[model samples]
Target: MCAYAGNQRLAGVRPRRPGPPPPLDPDAPIPDDPGPLLPDDPDDLPPAPHEPSPYTEPAPETPETEPEPV
Candidate 1:
């Protein structure tokens, strides 16, 4: 009896199954999908910082603190 290569790896493989083979998953990152993929409403999206994020911008003024003399 000859051992066929197809027999070694086909467990749970159904015979006479009609349709295209399962699609392969792509390992590469998609160019169109630059990530930080947002959820529809996971609420996990980080809240925007209330203040300006950049240090180059002047610090926001606050009423509680007096401005120090330079």
Candidate 2:
């Protein structure tokens, strides 16, 4: 039981044969395609002037100070 020492299944040494299951990623995105994946390249289309979202955190400036005479 000493093919080279320690734990190949306690040194009986026959556990290294698992290599043939990985070749399906040719650009990967076709699980079955029933027809709605639309991006044939109008510049990949998704940016036509919807610009109003700078992460929105600008509403905390309330120090105008002029209401003490009523």
Candidate 3:
């Protein structure tokens, strides 16, 4: 108990070590830095859907093109 917090800081009933940090709201609204991840920003948002990476090699089956006119 650290001697009852040093007798409550010599009877001053002390308990406040946090005062001096509230003056930076100059229209505070500028927090958006996320445009540089995939292929160096090629529309950075198509590479985070896991659960199918057996050494990654299973996306090649497109051979059915035969749609006649109406």
Candidate 4:
């Protein structure tokens, strides 16, 4: 006999049945009003500070006219 011949077949295996559904809550009916997730007033947010632009021109370079003796 093969080494795995005595093992149980998995073809008929299935997950166990789940328990009874949770009890329903009658008070969870749809709310009349849904409020915003964040504050409605502009004052509630912090002001963003200004940042320097990366596209600005760089400073001019000074020319070196003299060559050192070898």
lDDT of each: 0.61, 0.65, 0.65, 0.63
Candidate 1 C-alpha lDDT tens digits along 1-70: 2333554845555446588988877986656856567877755555567744443556568656778999
lDDT of 1 at 25: 77
Candidate 4's displacement at residue 58, Å, is 22
Find the number of clashing residue pairs for candidate 4: 0
Candidate 3 has an lDDT of 0.65
Model 2, span 1-70: residue lDDT tens = 4555653355345757889999888998767767768788866666556543455655656866788987
The residue-by-residue lDDT of candidate 4 on 1-70, one tens digit each, is: 3333356545655547999999989888886777777788966755444643455654458765788889
Clash counts per candidate, in order, are 0, 0, 0, 0
Query: Model 4, 55: alpha-carbon shift in Å?
Result: 28
For 1-70, candidate 3 gives per-residue lDDT tens digits of 4425543555544556998998998998999997755576545445556755555778769976889989
Best by lDDT: 3
Task: Estimate the TM-score for candidate 3.
Answer: 0.25
Better of 3 and 4 by lDDT: 3
- Please identify model 3 stretches exceeding 4 Å from their true place: 1-10, 25-32, 36-51, 56-70
